[model samples]
Target: MTTIEQASGAEPRGGGVEHVDVLVVGAGVSGIDAAYHLRERFPERSFAVLDAQEDRGGTWWTHRYPGVRSDSDLFTYGYRFKPWTGPSIAAGEEILAYLDEVIAENGLAGYIRYQHRVTAARWSSGDHRWTVEVTRGDTGEQLRLTTDFLWMCQGYYNHARPYQPRWEGMDRFAGVVVHPQRWPVDLDYSGKRVVVIGSGSTASTLIPAIAEKAAHVTMLQRSPSYYFAPPTTHELAVTLRQLDIPEEWTHEILRRQYISQYHWLARMSFEAPDELHTFLIESMRPLLPEGFDVEKHFTPRYRPWQQRIAIVPDGDLFAAVREGRVSIVTDTIAEFTEKGIRVGSGEEIPADVVVTATGFNLSLLGDVAFTVDGEPVDFPQRVTWRGVMIAGVPNMAYMFGYFRHSWTLRVDLVSDLVCRLLETMQAKGAATVVPTLRPEDDGMQLRPWSDPENFNAGYVLRSQHILFKQGDREPWTHMLEHEQEREILPNADLDDGSLVYR
Candidate 1:
């Protein structure tokens, strides 16, 4: 295990120690973006990015699942500073490579410490610093670090363990059962009947990809989910390049495409439920089996966007179904049999492999224990300050985004605001900063900040409500149009309500 020490030049002990101006946890997209911005804003202050995994690209590197493609398009998912170079919406390896490229191009590797899992953090009111504790993955050594600020980029989806539905006789089943996250590389599915459980994006993507090689692929879902077919890339790219529009204008047009699609879907889910259902059925009609009931196989009971809508490129999943390569089983799994799985309809489908794309367990705040001067911090007991920052937590911010919109939209905005806030702190000679919302701030009453019905779990509960609340208010809510974000967050007030400076 090679350990690279920072230039502080202190003698290393068993339980190493270090201090810096800032500590950004989870070296994923959010963490890396935050660290880069901090360096740009505060070139003199030292900052470090720490991640539990030995490698970079948090989920991209850790998730070895089959057919792991992003739900969002590459054009919107890639960072503003770095343009993605892939043709079709890139796969997992492509995204990871893009992240690595960004890190290398920006020379961010020197500031990152891999295999450091942060366990706890405490705010010191007297010293105005966060005392962070972490475990070293290599040596199992506990280490302590201090920094003026703590930025959490650990996305909501990364920490929680993948959820697998419990079925009787699962252990007795002779065939292999695999969770997408733990997909066995050498397990051959060729010429074997495969049953994939769930209707989320992961399952949808996997069914199509695996159907091409497997003898038979079956998608089993307790209830159907809204699936939309979007173009692989925005048409704005072609038009802008053809028309020779300025890069800024092309970017603006692409931004509009993203915003329009998000709002159109959001509005359909919120207002025109019946119309949305009709639109979905019409779009899916050509793909369903001749006698298949569209309502039974495609219609969902929940409102649109109740859970996230899964996106497939040009109806690839539906096309797979149409080709007789994949089959849809709209029934709950009652139990597992030695030969296959039994459905609630008393029908047993023979399968040689079972893939559980069930869902995930939700955990907030990186599951990191927080304390103030050694007193435990209860997150549920406290109200959110602005949907991003929590009250009484000094110099800390969470990377939260909208469930209805692409996550990068909100993450980018939050990152921009964080940079501006840091610059403001430097200008004011502030050692610590915390946002305090007014007691009667109408922002809290805007919408269901989090969705209780959609049980995919993790940071969604806390962040959902927070993002919704911010969307209804100013400064907190930037217009979905990208140019607006570029302007608003950069100049937004750091002292809006009460950002106490010490």
Candidate 2:
């Protein structure tokens, strides 16, 4: 940590805001990555990571529902800089342990200030700084901080408020209703009938974990979602460890393997969707019970990779269904009955507990109110510069990760880009660097943050209006291709007309 430097015409000492070279808005995977890169790349600079939670592990720490685990493999989900020694599909506690190890080993614990929530940020071009308002969760005390650059890595969703649908008779139901986001820590489900709504990853993970303990668990969804059940452990990792290969080598090898596999799947989804869809559906057949209606329960109306496919470890969800521990009901909820829920098919399922695992509410910039030079930032009207920086916002970068592959892949790339941008500013002796629309880009068409035709996850579609827009030209678009970006971002031209420095 560096001593606070008072800016011109600003308060000093106790009543003044602390200053740093970079202020990271979250202590999650992205923030930690940013901190590590900053320390390694620019050791002379001062930076601090702030997170609203009492501890780190943003999503992993926030979500405490039973059977919560990564929907994607850990090899890719884990940071590229770290080697994940755990299973490919890891539990919440395992991930937290891994994060703790990273923080402890890197001596990054000192840079992170937990329980500090950023409520608003105001960028001052004249002062060449950003004044941020923070609320301390522990003491409920208000604080202020100023930084030369703002790094928004707080994640894409609102942790406190999850997407929960309201049924007409939810209040009339006699049993307890729960949303997985706010799962009760002490709630008992043993020997009780549980009905889980939604067939997304959360529901899939929770169903098998609670099925054995609960008397009966039913998955009720209006539409089906695709599922992929791979072995929890990758054979290559096993072989590498057996051969006494270095952990770094194994991590890189496995990370590349997963990325290549996902790339193939992504290309197949776009170029040969029917064949890819057939391959996915056929893959699930052998794992399911004999004569199981795969079309009714597992078939999604959209093409493969349109939305994220849930990863089921060793086909556990299917095994539970095979053993009759779990039942799948595909129908709209007519209403909540006193005992359970009534379906559109005129069938009433009995349940003592109901869990809504539908989805989450997308939050833009951690829902932090942002202003640039006394003007509020209307994100929906602004365009993204390479999916990292929002146009017209000076010295700020937000981490919006991938939908087809691991998010941290992009996080690593963005961290590199941001560092490079800072170096460019230093080299030019510029105080600010903002993405501005060039003369040629005057008539460029703006699209939604994400293309619905390619990726239309329900949560994204619902909150698309709040997300920043993407442009049609190069450097103005948010390209989701990790392979292409691997080559493009490293050599991206900082002197390009898309960015203006002052």
Candidate 3:
């Protein structure tokens, strides 16, 4: 963590105000990565990280719902600069703790201002800077700040809006209704009948955790989701490291495990759908009830990876079902009744508590309003430059994680690349840099990274397009292949026709 010095001028000058080399919004995994790299590249320039929340860890801290855990393994989710020192697959608290450690270790606390929410940002072509308006959450005060470069790290989930499906008689229901994103901390479910709606990772994880105390737990799925179970710890890697294999070699082997799984899933999604379904069923057979039908509870109408798949921590969800502590109901939710919910299949299930884990509304680019020289820029109408920068937007970038691989995999690469780009620009005394897609490059028609229809709440659904776009050639096409990213992203031709410099 480097020391901070105040800019020479603090007051606003005409439309342009206090100027910084870069202004980063949101202090989550992406924002932190961006700031760290920016400092490494240009330590002389001024940069700041602003977050709406009072603390860091963006979504991890925002979401306090019970049974929260990462679907991806922690080994790959952590930043490259910092190694995650915990079990392979970590719980929500563990990940949050890691973020805290990174912030403290880097001494980024002084560089970040919490409770400052950016309302809008407009680029001035004449001045070659952005005038940003921010609202102070504590005092409802407004302040103006300007920067030459704007990096949007705020992710897609709407922090305020919880996705609760409209049921005809929801208001009349007697039981407490909650959304997983806004689970009340003081609420207790001891000896109560709880029904978790939706079949994604959240509900799957919630069922098993809640079943321990809840009298009966039921997972109501409007549609089935593919579920798979794998050990949280890798036995082979553990054995190899114990046998005196180098730790780096062990790490590489563990990373390869993730790559293999990612490729298998991609192939299943693009080529062999039936085989994928069969493989999942076969893997889950040992954990299912003696006479339960796999098709009824696990088979989804959509193709593999069409929607995000739910992963259990070593078959905990299936074990809970097998023990009769948790049950699954594959039926349409008809309406809310006085005591519970009524399904379209004409069954009324009684519950003391109901949790709606339906999904999230995608809010791209942190839902921040942007304008260029007082003219607003329509984001969706613009082309994505390498899936990171937007065409026609200068000195601006957005951090999007890998869709098919771990979130940190691409994030780390993007951070490194950004640092190098800054370094190159500074060396040449360039004021602004932006990447643009060639109009003749028909990359938009290429296969999308993930299924467009696959829906999940928060960051998962928002940045799905990143997967198919070429981050680099060959093995680096996927985020997990960091060696390729190290080679291509940091040292790539900065003067390429795609990037504009001034």
Candidate 4:
């Protein structure tokens, strides 16, 4: 109900610095969620959503590879406040449209500023505010802004540079080698032999989409990853629609159902991994060819749920393989020959196009330079406060979502907790709030941002040294399950010894 001007406390000083109550970074799903909560809870607070990308839909806008879609169901991936009337599994464009609807319905478009990238954030305790430096992607101009609170929703991975390892003779390959993250729109693969490297979601999705156009498609992987083939539409959702139930009712019902199912699956991974693994592999047997080596190509060395289980809607990937449009090769790459890639066994797979669906590098806070009172932030040495705020950092919260459940589930939870904290700050007449270590917590053992034992994805393992650490006790540790945090975050005490207010 409040315009940016009405919510702002300070006027622009000679066009040098503008002031807002809160500044949200990134216009993606998480940032949008944060914007909604802030406006709803503190309608009088001025805030702006800044994204480096040219448009909205952070990761959705950045990734344009063929067949890019959500591996998680839309029922939970969609916002808790919105109703998703589409199928459970949605394509990239569909997801973007969903985001567009949210912005239009909530009048959030006015608050979002595209092509505005925050490069540096410096907190000054003396002023009780943060001075942020931004670069305009549209124009080569720099801008400065000040805010009382900062909310970071930038995704974890680096969008510009993807992780592509060099092969023995990569330079000698005659075929065009492309990373999925940077797929070229004009690069044609039609009627050409395509070899996709790595067996993650990108590889699985690409093979099916490009298989029909390409002469032959092959999935080359160092090791297999677990895959699940859920139906595009949930039967309950379909039934609810047929019964004339409202879309909002259907969305809420399906969201809770998926959350419970995901919780159970995560539990099974920890309690009975072998049994769960067997079920996942067996489920794929009917979709694959009878003589296909499921154990060799579909089975994974690690347990299911350790890494994300790639969701293949209605077994499209398997259908492509079963119909002889695609093939899977499980072997390490020996080198890249002039024609194509050669495996460790000395077998050469000829291809006209080599798609390195390898993965991406992790970026800490969007690679922004952050300082607390002019001192650079050393993230590894700092402990996280409930995975939301970094300890000793004043009035800042970042959104790191759940790995076991849909990411937006955590976004909504974190939004609730943050809005409540803001309300507490208002009631107490505080200028700044920071998390600090109490005397009793001085000797607690510190752990990595993500426990390798719990979730050791390639990007996470590579970025541990640059990420914030967690502690052994509550209020300091993070990466909790949705079920657990759903109960703990709302009731968390603001007067706990962890937070210091002034």
Candidate 5:
């Protein structure tokens, strides 16, 4: 067998080895979800969790920028097992609290090793197990663990440093520059002119919030993003809670409605582009002033949901714009000037602070390296089997959420699949389960896994060629809708010849 390593930092092997039936690599929502199912499914098997961060709430814990909250409803984003007892759109702190509640309620805290960052994993055919290496964040010490199954719940991005483009004369600009990813708690933007770059969720949410305190806030966008202000609390969700209805039933009903509307809108965006675009523009009409240039400022050049539909809670962003505290400049940024940025129109926007809300750099499995029998596992060379597991990779799977829908919706289903997969392996006396492609599959047509034309987010477009591709059929297509995932994950035949057990 060949042995390779992408993990580093050597230390004395001072402790005895410990083995487990499963090693879940994360402590966030996905990791906690996986652990709960594993414990319930295999009561006798040993299991543990590892997380790189010191706290729970993966992205929720890291992104503490002003006005940072969920873009979707809490009912669907929250766990199905536990109902969210808070607002429909919750802040980062609230989500973290909910995560803590879940961990405490399930007694999963004792099983998680926080600050333990996993760097590499290898599958050994001879041993039928994986050797994993983790580096401690507090100390530089390295620890190794062996597991029969490896579940990757560590999300899909580099949160430590977000994408920062080099702006010309940025160093010479006499102003504070900050990315929304690393927001300083003590930052005082009051009475200062603020220019926020990008029209994505971060900028959309930040403009109104900072405008409340700043002298003026301008959302500088190269192109417009589709946005709509959904209610902060769904009237039905609130009514049901007040009427003493079981949240489970109410939430399930809400889930179906939300999913249907989302799917329908997405279908309309592709099927009838002009109609959908016109409808969306009309929807934004009441939010702005009567004579506002809604077409030029709010109307996007592309169809809705192609990237993402940014949501503002309760029309707060629009209110700020109407109040004249917030403004929008639709133009390309030429470069950074001494005071602010110069636009392609030859006009300069002066600001005391320039916030770059540009977005993240997509990195899979925390940028960890993997291998099987000593050969490096190049992900771009692989195809995403069922959108969760990979071909030729045994006893391993990563929970990459749906791009078109809420991440938790798909991850919840994936966690269930992992539990089901583990149970099926045990019942059949199997040591390893790997998805195998059929001989006929060799001739099937395929496309780039995440085509920019299909899912055109900046981070996604930049890294689509590096991700796993898929064929044109089921199990290979990996549909992104939540309804499709919920329907297919449970009832699908486990021994359907594509997933092989040995």
Candidate 6:
């Protein structure tokens, strides 16, 4: 990681006071999208995008482990406004380049200030503004900026640190141990016996890529996760390229088709878990050796869509197993051994290097402390307004993409909502726009954001209490389905009694 170089002149004219129409926190994908959408309507609105990271790409910049790529295809994950002209499944560097192009082309580079981590935000009812405190990473100096609106686009995961489990005998391991999140650029795993601990997408990607050079790679999983091999190239996109259709229209059509199929398959899995289960198993039978029990290594105990299926471009993982480069060990790690790891099955997986591709640490609103009118904001006590804004949080909207579908899908809708809300407020001559719950809304049933039935991701469950709840019904609950959110968030009346415009 590069050191954050502090820019000269911290304060503005010997004072920390500077005002803008909006102050955007975190210049990740969501923040970039928010800036683009806001620029579309309110180009004149003075806003700044602050990022804690030293560079442009947020998660993409953070995780540089070998074969780090999108969990979903880029076509869907890429912003709705900006079509991903790259491969369907793009690598981290490719995605980072895409972000760079978006920022450069749209003139967003100047507006973004890196190494400025937002610490606290206090909203004042009298001023109708947020006084946000940001700490410069290089210098210990703290700075303040006041803005009419606060857009939290920092994403939902904790990037400051990776979630490392406290395993027995971790300190005794002689060989190089690394988490995929903090992969050392100079570290070498060439011809080394490597064991990757986890079966999620990170482990899936790392094993195959490392197996090319490593003498052997073993993906050690507690159980199993559903695996799918999507074609590296979008066939529809390829076909459209041969024709005279504009890239924008072609991209839009393909995006819609992919999203539609996802919704259909997700519904089908719930309707007939048995049928889906059989189909998933049958699909991978040919990929393995004849009579190989794919059910053991590839089949997940839970139904589909419970957790996202681990995807690899063009069956890379399956091919690796078939070619005898990588192996899957579905057993719990008893403990980390000095030599390697000992499994619950009394199996000793000796390795020279161990990579823990465990999942991320969940955090809310970039884990920044928030207050309104001197009262602390408890997210769990508040219901979401279209799954974007917390009810009663004035002039504030945080972007949390769809867990079921590509995150960009929901972000697009929420960005549209933010632009429209701001436009409506300006038109109505309103200073404050808070999602004020109606008397009837007070009686609604609420559920945890990390509910197992709704979202079964492990990290989400860990930070459930820190997250905002969803009601049993609309505007309050997040319609995890993209089509549902697209229809609801964009079309909902801005003047509805839910939002108090004062």
User: lDDT winner among the candidates?
Assistant: 4
In model 1, how large is the Cα lDDT of residue 461?
Answer: 52
Candidate 1 lDDT over residue span 1-502, tens digit each: 2233572322333445667777889888788888778766677878888888889987787777777888876656777666554533668898888888888888788888898888999899898888788888888877788778888888766344766668898998999999887777898998999999888888998888888889999999899988888666556677667787776566556765766777787677657978887887788787666776778888887767777788887788988888889888899888999999999999999999999988765557678888988888766545554456776678898886556566677777788887777778888998988765555564454334453653333335534532323324553332233344546655666776657787
Instruction: Write one digit per residue (lDDT tens) for candidate 5, span 1-502.
Output: 2111211211122254556778888888789888888767777777888889988878887888898898887787888888787778888888889888988898777778888898999899999999888888877678787788999998877888799988788998999999998999999999999999999888988788889899999999988998878888888787888888987788787777677777787788778978888887888889987799987888776677778888888988889888999888999989999899999999999999999999999877778889999999998878878888888999998887777677788888888888888889989999999988877687777778776667788888887777878887767777556666688887767887888899
Clashing pairs in 3: 449-468
* Model 3 regions lying over 4 Å from their true place: 1-17, 240-252, 436-493
Q: What is the per-residue lDDT of model 4 for residues 1-502, given as tens digits with 9 covering 90 to 100? A: 1112322334564455788889999999999999889878888778888899988998899999999999899999999899999999999999999999999988888888888888999999999999888888777578788899999999787998889899899999998999988999998999999999999888988889999899999999999999999999999999999999999999999999999989999899999999999999999999999899999998888888878899999999999999999999999999999999999989999999999999999999999999999999998899999989999999999987887789999999999999988998899999999999989898999999899889988888888989999999989999888889999998898898899999
lDDT of 1 at 18: 69
| Candidate 4 Cα lDDT to native | 0.90
* Model 6 local distance difference test score: 0.83
Evaluate all candidate structures by whole-model CA lDDT and list the values in order.
Answer: 0.74, 0.89, 0.75, 0.90, 0.83, 0.83
- Per-candidate clashes, comma-separated: 6, 0, 1, 0, 1, 0
Q: Report the Cα lDDT for residue 490, model 5.
A: 74
Pull out the clashing pairs in model 6.
none
**Order of quality (TM-score):** 4, 2, 6, 5, 1, 3
For every candidate, C-alpha RMSD to the true structure in Å: 4.0, 2.6, 4.5, 2.3, 3.8, 3.0
Candidate 4 weakest lDDT stretch, 10 residues: 1-10
Pairs with backbone N, CA or C atoms under 3 Å apart (clashes), candidate 2:
none
lDDT per residue, candidate 6, 394-484, as tens digits? 9999988877688888888888888888889999999999998888777889888756975587787777877788888667777567756
Order the candidate numbers by lDDT, best to worst: 4, 2, 6, 5, 3, 1
lDDT of model 6 at residue 167? 84
In angstroms, the error of model 5 at 86 is 1.3
- Cα displacement (angstroms), candidate 4, residue 306, comes to 1.1
lDDT tens per residue, model 3, 1-502: 1112334223345544455778889999889888777766667777888899988888887888877888887767877677655667777899888888888887677778788898899887778888788887877877778888888898767788856678899999999998988889998999999999989888887788889999999999888888878787767767876798766666666776776777678667658888988898889888989988778888888777666667887999999999999999999989999999999988999999998988765566766888877777776456556556766778887787865567777887777766777777778888877665555554444333433454343445555543224323221123333444546665667676677778
lDDT of 4 at 100: 95
